[model samples]
Target: MIILQANQLSKAYGAETILSSIKMEIKHRDRVAVVGRNGAGKSTLLKMIAGELPHDGGELIIPNAVSVGYLPQQAVLSSDKSIWDEMLDEFSDLLAIEQRIRLLETKMGSEETLSNEASYNKIMKEYDTLRADFEARNGYQLEADIRGILSGLQFNGFDYYHTTVSSLSGGQKTRLALGKLLLTKPDLLILDEPTNHLDIDTLTWLEGYLQGYPGALLLVSHDRYFLDKIVNQVYEISRTHSQRFSGNYSYYQEQKALQYERDLKEFEKQQSEKHKLEDFVQRNIARASTTKRAQSRQKQLERRDWMDRPDGLEKSVAFTFPTDQVSGHDVLRVRDVTLQYDDQKEPLFPSSSFHIDRGERTALVGPNGVGKTTLLHMLRGQMPPSTGSFQLGSNITLGFYDQEQAQLRSTKTVLQELWDRYPSFDEKDIRTVLGNFLFSGDDCLKIVNTLSGGEKARLALAILMLKKANVLLLDEPTNHLDIDAKEVLEAALSHFSGTILFVSHDRYFMNQIATKVLELLPSGLTTYLGDYDYYLRKKEEEKERLALDALEQPKTDQEDGAQNESKESFEQQKDAKRKKRQQERRMAEIEELMQQTENEINALETALLQPETYEDHEKAHDVQLALQQANQTLEDLLVEWDECSTDNA
Candidate 1:
């Protein structure tokens, strides 16, 4: 069924057109992605479809019966209700139905109603209908559904029953909003920048969930990996026009390039023929013998329609990081480093050690609030580690790109921001650099504070390019960049001779530029000697190996017992065996407790590391104390397990 259709849908802000006669359609279960550079009106188009904004012209058709849900980039949930209650609100009608069914049951069981066969039957029928409706809606599994979605969106670690909606971080609120939207199960779901705040694990789970979603999905995102995984159809919105491609983002890229090439060739051929006809008419129109032929050619030219040349390639920021000198073989070495925020709660990672070699691009990946940014800060000496140290190799010069763009002077103009730093450079040279970054003419005169996020990112990269450092430390460098800018940065970094240690949630960017993957867990860091895809494959293989090991463990134990049965007398062996079994059970229980304690400590540590907690002295202190207690319990459990094993032996 066609859930939505927009024919020549046009939206404009006063005189400025945002969307120009755009056509799009969404059928049942269609997965469509809207992609373009920043300021290409992708979000505006979504808002128009969502009915949050009025279109200036054209028609948008959505079936009256078809339900639609829209999630914007920044969705604020202003409620005093707890997370679980807020989610339950999505099913208020079902809950009301359930209550009605209970009331009907009460009426049927009353002696007054039961005495009358007609009334009893009527009440029972109502109850049955309500029950059927509830079951059809899967009302009994409501809590399970909530839990599943919360877990998929990485909210399992949260205390849903106690945590109020107002207390959540912006990202957490966005996730909760998404969970609520998913539970509504509208016929058409539209999401804008849905992957903005999601970590890799959550992104992976969301991709799978959306892939199997029953409703049609219309998404606007800069995440290429996500688009490639979840979207089957891609709509490229450029210059206020929309072009549809019947495939994933990768397929769209390939097909778009091919289409452009074909159009360009065709356009050139038409231009060539037109030029030849015009030349012949000009040379022969004056001659009496060929005048008739010239007139015929002129008439043919008037009758012919010429093809307009295909649009020139869209303007994109050009990026390159060239170093005048190469770093030593060992670019960076981190030894037993532990990052801790003020008030000194739990460490980010427990005594993690890793190294980056010269010319190697290592991607630092982890869940949000896992201190990926802190680690970069420590590496660059912007922040000190609570424990241990890191060192740069000899002759290595470091360049840092802050995702926040905090290094840029807000008081200075865009041109001055670069020129002030490099005073020796001529005005033309500075303009040349700015032009390459897509800032030209009056654009360079804009103050740094007035620039958009994308512009700031470009300026930062332009500055980084001029630094010519041998070692680069980047914190979410692709955060504000559009798809084209990201691709440009990826290409530049791929060819960069310098070593790179960067943190990013963009899996596609990592796949393109990273030679190695560093996964930071609460336990420590694990290095995967390959790109994002390779790392994912290895992680799956590891899970399978562990599963198989677990399945064979009991059999291995039984075999060992069987082989030892004949080696001893019945009574003595039986006594020892019983003691051994008891010890083993105790050890297992202690080990489980130890693991739980460690997890609790890690969770507390993560909580303390959050900006809100660290900023509050009392909260940080309480969490720090809890973390210490958890650590003590874990230590005692380990000692008890060791003693038990010794006694059994």
Candidate 2:
């Protein structure tokens, strides 16, 4: 069932239209994502759907029974109540229902009501109905639900429950708001930039939780990895229009590229045909013998339908990191490094040791408040470690991209910020570089303080590019960058010859550019040889191993000795031989099945390539479906074959 629908929806501020005639729909249990570049009216459209903002034009149809809970980008919770009580407020209605049930129980137990059959029966019926409703709402497990959500959101600090709502930090308050929203259990849950302050662990937990969520989900987030894992449908708002894709973010990207190519080809074909018609009309109109034919052609041309060109392409900032010099093979070395804010508190990392080789892109990652930024600062010499030391390689020049962009002077204009630092560069050269970062014309005159977070980030990157340092230290470099900018930066960094040590929460970015991952922990730094995905897989394998080990009982010395002595027994040897023969037979069977499935898949693929199959949509679809099923069967057989071969070995 369609819970919400928008028909020609539009929103405007004065004369500037943010969303123009946008149409979209959200069905029951739909995991929909509205994605766009910064300031592309994604949030505005969400607000319109949530009824927080009024639409300038068009109709928004929402079923009256569907309750929507909207958590804006910056949700503020101001209350004198403690965090626990604030969360309890979400269940006020259920609490009231419970109160009525209690009152009914009291009246039902009274002598007057007991003597009255009508009153007692009515009270019993009311109690039964109320009890069922309460159970359906999970009223009895409210505290358990709240606790689970809070733990999943990583609210385990000392002040998690004790702190008052008004006393919490902005990020803490946002988290609390999210917890409350989840507890409310609305039919439709809408979250804007919900992953803004989430760490990797918390993000993983939230992804699992939302995957099992009972209601429809609509979220706007710049976290591509999060979107790919959560959202099944993508509605991209670009160039004042909306386009829908029937798959996850990664699939959407593939389909979008294919659609663009197809549209471009169609456009070129139409243009070629129109030009030929025009040329024929022009040549024949002047000849008296072909005047009637020319006139007919002119009429046809006037009545011809023209296609509108696809216009979603907008200019994006270009980024490149070029080094002026090369550093030694040993880019960085750390030995027994320990970091702590104060002596009274525990150290963030104790006896951490790591090294960054030349041209190695290392990503520092951990849970929030695990001192990723502190470690980066220590490496930059801005903070001194409590113990041990780190040394930079010979002739290593450093360029840093601060997450807060504090290196930028707020008083200076965009043009002056770059030109003032590099006095040797001419004004035109500086402006040209700024323009490359998307600061052109009058935009160069805007003060740094007034610029948006994205603008400040671009300006910082521009300076970093000009620095041409051999060692780049980036702190949350992908923060505040739109998806497009992040992609561009990823490309630039992937091509850079310099060594890099950066801290980021962007798993997708890390997967693209990171050569190694250094996970900072309270215990110490753990290094992974591969990217973020590899790190996660390794961690999961380690977890599984630990869990399996936990399940096994410890053997006594006598039992161990007896088992060791019985290892070469005749019965054991005979059983092992039989098991090995069985494993070998199973492996052979799996291989045979895999080969057969592969052959079937190949046949179907070949049939799909034939003209008769290709021309008929239904036939082609059937062939493709059969090929997919065959491929899946082959994959299963391969897995089984591997397991059997391992057992035999």
Candidate 3:
């Protein structure tokens, strides 16, 4: 069914037109992506479609029962509630049903209810209906569902559930907000730049989740790889007009290129014919015999309709990394380098070792908080590693591109920003570089503080290019760049002769520029001598091998020990076996106890909610005490179980 359809949808801000005429349709479970440049009105169109921003003209149709969930660029969630509680709010109706069922259970068990057939029947009927509704909605797995979403959003630790929304960072809050929205399961999910803060791992996870989602998805994101994986249809908003493409990002690019080429050729052909006609008219108009023919040609030329030139690709940033000097063959080397945080029980990086050769574009990748950027910082001499050492080879000059563009002087103008980097250069030369980076004319006078993220990124690139450093360390270099700018940057980096040790979650960039992949893990660094796709394939193969190896493990009993050995050795082995067996037994015991404790806590909670228990202080207190003890016991069991499992591993 068509959940939404827009015909000639128009939106504007006073005299300025944003979306003049937009047309698109979203059917059941349609994966649609809205793509455009930074200021191309993509967001405005989405806002209009979502009804967050009013439309000035045209029609948008949404079915009465079709629910929509919109996530703006910044998911602003203001709440004092804990993360888990805030998520629980999404299922308030199901929770209400649960409460009603509990009340019915309490009433049905009463002597008065048992003595009255009509009252008992009515309560039982209500309870049956509520229970069926709850079951239909998967109410029995409420906690499990919530846990799955939280973990997928990287809120895995037990304590994260209790962390209030106000305490979370903006990015973390955005993640939490996304998780809460998933729980709501709206019919249509519209997201703006949903992949902004997601790392490669989280991006893949979300991609998988959305692929399996039953609802339609309409999202705007500059992440091309993300768009390629999730979207089947693309709506492009350009020059205040909308065009729909019936394919993913890659397919759209191909079609757009082909169409442009066709239009260009047609225009050139017509111009050639017109030029021939003009030349003939000029040559023959003076001759007496050919005067009629020349006049006829001139009249034909005047009557013919002319086609305007088709627009080409947008002007993108164009600059290359010019190395000042040659570097040694070994650009950088590290041995046993890692960091151990005081708060973390395990070191974030465990004796990780890797090296980058001269001219190698090494792409460093890992999950969030796995210290990819921190490792780059250590290499840049911003800080020392917790242990081990890393060294740069002979005559290596490093240039760093921070994702935040923190190195740029916000007080300076865009023109001054580049000029300040190279004092001896001619002013024209500096301006030329800035102009190549899309800071032409009056744009160069804009203050850095007022520049957008993409503008700041361009300014930073201009400086990095002028620095002429032989080795570059980039952290999320594509952070604020749109798809076009990212492609330009990727091409520039690909052509650079110097070694590149950069961290990026842009999988498309990784695949485009990476000659090698360094996967930073808790255990150590794993090197894949290929692009992102090769790394993924190898990872899957490794996973399958590990699964098979796990199943092939040999099992032995206490009787399988060596029959004859030195007493010391025999006794030590026997004691170790006995301890292992005891730990295993304790694990089984804890599992049983945890289940019992959960049942006890539920029963106690139900009793505490009853009228008889709450009306009497002594009974209420006793039940509450029992519930507390049960909860504490469950917590203890979980900790012990985790330890025993770790020991076994």
lDDT of each: 0.88, 0.87, 0.86
Model 3, C-alpha of 335: deviation from truth (Å): 1.6
Candidate 2 lDDT over residue span 1-649, tens digit each? 8899999999889988899979888888778999888889999998988889999999999999999999999898889898888889877899999999999989998999999999899999999999999999898898799889888888877465678888877887888899899888788999999988788888888887887688999999889999988877789999888998766788788989899888888888888888888888999999999988988988888898877676646788897999998999998999998888765578876788999999899999998888899888888889999999999999899998899887775688999888988999999999989988999999999999889888999999999999999999999998888888888899999999999999988899999999999999877789999999999989977975675454344668887665555543634766787898688667645644654575588789899999999999999999999988898888888888778767766
The C-alpha RMSD of each candidate to the native structure, in angstroms, is 20.0, 8.7, 19.8
lDDT of 3 at 333: 86
Candidate achieving higher TM-score, 2 or 3: 2
| TM-score, one value per model | 0.84, 0.84, 0.81
Locate the minimum summed-lDDT window of 10 residues in model 2.
562-571
Worst lDDT window (10 residues) for model 3?
A: 558-567
Q: lDDT tens digits, residues 137-201, model 1?
A: 98988889899999999888889999999999988999999999999889999999999889999
Global CA lDDT computed for model 3: 0.86
Off by over 4 Å in 2: 100-123, 159-161, 556-649
Segments in model 1 whose C-alpha atoms lie over 4 Å from true places: 110-113, 554-649
Query: Candidate 3 lDDT, tens digit per residue, 148-266?
Result: 88888888864755689998889888988888888777899999988877877788889879976889999999889998878877888888888877667998899899989999999
